[model samples]
Target: MPELPEVEVVRAGLAPAVTGATVISAEVRDPRALKRHLPLGADGLPGDDGLGGHGVRLPFEAGVARAADFERRVTGLVLDAPRRRGKFMWIPVERGAGDESQPGSVPIPLVERGARDESKPDQLALLAHLGMSGQMLLRAHDAPDDRHVRIRLWIEHPAHGELRLDFADQRLFGSLALDRLLPAPDGIDLIPGQALHIARDPLDPAFDDAGFLLALRRRGVGVKKLLLDQTLVSGVGNIYADEALWRARIHPETPGTAIGPRKARELLSALRDVFTQALAEGGTSFDAQYVNVNGQAGYFAHSLNAYGRQGAPCPRCGRPIVRESFMNRGSHFCPKCQQLR
Candidate 1:
């Protein structure tokens, strides 16, 4: 799965190509790609006849029908600048004045103003989750589709002409949904309601450093476990957790309450540093599936200190890195530098 850095890289790469562009056509080749938006009724399956009672229709139905609905709602809307929080990315859609009869008349402005009025419900958003093997690729209009391409969109831009945006997911766990934008507590006008529970990543401007440190000291769970909790702190996955802990000289098994204010502050600083370094390196890519929009692998994997280098020499203390079973996953750390209390 792509972490904060990798997702941010994708978001940054896509902003230029899709922002303000009108979606000419939207197609979902796989019904599973929209499973998240499809709500299951009491029967554990889609309602009878695909349309539920009282004119309420389930979003998840026959692939062709769902695709047609998606096309109807999003065909002529202008996709605003994409925004990201942790591993989730969404593009707000604006009902432009562009003529539906004419295919590419909408002009995408270079300057991006923030969301319009929060009270007015004139906008819809497209939420994308890049599951384990999901990739969002921007291809030429004439490019061939990859075997895993699940959703393809024809976007029209004033400067770039027509471009094909492809969402390819090999595992079928990734999804795309059309959701309503709700006003966030922090005054951000365009946060999806489903993502309101997710805490902000450290790189976000609204991230609360002091508040996180205080909460970290209060949580009685293991330090690494707390780090992995999305509610406590978003975007710190297993690999980054080990790296950040190793950098802070804190053991993965240490109790969160045992960490005092100073060590807590150090851990927080190390986390920010780790995320910043990984972002600079374009994130750690150990396999071909994890790549930027251009299909380039990240270089941060080579710079890792403790994540996958089990039995390798630790950079700080020269001790062989140890791997331990944790929550059905393996955790790598330097035994000498990060001793369990």
Candidate 2:
């Protein structure tokens, strides 16, 4: 699965092309890919518009199979720049030009980047989750369809010509959905309703370090487990968790309550440093499954110290790194350096 850095890379690449662009139409090649969408009506047609009828439902092809609601709701809505929180990425609706219910109604304010007027009407966003082998590729409209492409959205940009955004998933674990955009608990940013429980990543400017440290010293769970907890601190996956723990000289299984404030702060700082470096390098890509919108692999995989370095000599200490089974995956660390305390 693509972590925070990987998702951020995709979000950044899609920002310029998708922002202020119009969604011409949507084609669902696979119904399983839209499992997260609203349930269809008994008549197998779109029911009431969940977005308060803010967007007009455009006519869709009746010949197509699968969910037509995804296609109808997505069409005709202008999109804002793609936004991300942790591994979750979404493109919010900038405006519904064809909406005649409220003529000349001001467009809803975008979350985070736009003004925060709680009184504004709710909006919708196209939410995406790249499971194991999902890729979002921006291709020329006439280009050959990517293998295993589950969904395609035809979009037209003001400056750029028509383009196709392909959502391809080899393992069929990823999904796309039309979800409501609601203000986060902090009220500082807007997040898709499905991702509301995810905590802010360490790189987020609003991330509370002091509060996190306080919580870290209270949990009895393993420190690594705590890091992986999306509600506690989102985006620190297995790969980066080991790396950050190595930098902090703490064992992966070290209980969070056993870690003092000084060590907790050090771990937090190490996480941010690792995330920053990974973002700079695009993101860690061990296989072709993970790539940016341009279908380019990240280079951060080459800079890894702990994860996937089993039996390799540690950079800090000369001891060979060991791999241990963890949560159905492998955890790599330097035993000599990161001793259980």
Candidate 3:
């Protein structure tokens, strides 16, 4: 799956093309893409899979929803700015004029508001999860569809003209949904209600350094595990985790509680550096499966220092980088510089 940097690249590429564009039409070519949207007003029903108005069972799990309603709700809405948290990306939408408030009502900003004012209406959003092998591409309206294309949106933009937004996923794990945007608990502006539990990524302006340090000390899990925990910190996947560990000279298996405040700060700094560098390089794409909006592979793979470089000499010291089996994943680091506790 694409991590923060890769997802951010897609988000940045998509913002200009899709933002402020009105949805001319939306087509869901595959049922799997609509798995995350619940049927309208189906949340009040009891049971895990209660039958919806459409006679289909409501998908109760995260990222699972009734497909028919998902398609119907998003057809005519205008897509606002695209935003991302961790690997998740979403576009806020405005209802058609008929659904708007009466004249003289306070107009709401298209972007999520900073305050948690329940009296203000929540904005509707189109959420997307790019699970493994998923790609969002902007193509010409007349272009041919890719083999794995699951959803396509025809958008009309005043400046850019008409364009087609394609969501392609070779594997069926990725999905798109219509969701409500609720204020973040920390008073940060809107985030999908379904994604309320996800912690702020290091790149987010609202990331709390003091809060993260306190949580890290309390978790007592392995450093790599804590790094991978979406609740503690978002967007540091296996590759970046390894790179950050190597850069910080900390062993991946070291307990989070065991890391001192100075070391923890160092680790966070390393994480930011790695993320910024990877994003500049377009993210670490080893193959064609991970690409930007233009379908071009990232060059960050060439800049990898630790991950997938088992047995290669460490850039810091002359010692060889070694790979260790870790929680069903391989962690690469310099055994000499990043000694096990």
Candidate 3 lDDT over 1-341, as tens digits, reads 58999999999999999888888777877766665655544333211343332334333442234444455566667899899988889999987655344333223334433555646556878898887788999998998777688888888877899999899998766778777787788876889877888899998888999999888877777899999999889988899999999999999989988999999999999999999999999998887778888888888999998999999999889899999898998999999999978
Q: What are the per-residue Cα lDDT tens digits for candidate 1 across 81-189?
A: 9998777789998876754454433322222125655354435588888877778899899987776888888999878989988888988767787666666667765
TM-score, cand. 3 vs. native:
0.86
Runs in model 2 lying further than 4 Å from the true structure: 40-66, 99-120
RMSD of each: 6.4, 6.4, 5.4
lDDT value, candidate 2, whole model: 0.81
Q: What is the lDDT of residue 250 in candidate 1?
A: 97
Worst 10 residues of 3 by lDDT: 45-54
Model 1, stretches more than 4 Å misplaced?
38-65, 98-119
Q: List the residue pairs that clash in candidate 2.
A: none
**Candidate 1 overall Cα lDDT vs. reference?**
0.79
Q: What is the lDDT of residue 124 in candidate 3?
A: 79
Flag regions of model 3 displaced more than 4 Å.
41-65, 98-120
Please report how far candidate 3 places residue 291 from its true position, in Å: 0.9
lDDT per residue as tens, model 2, 1-341: 58888889989999989998898889988766764565344443323324222132322332132356677667778989898887888999855576434433333333322465656555788899887778889998899877889999999999888999999998767778877787799999778888999999999999988888888889998899999998889888888999899889899999999998889999999999999999999998998889999899999999999999999999998899999998898889999999986
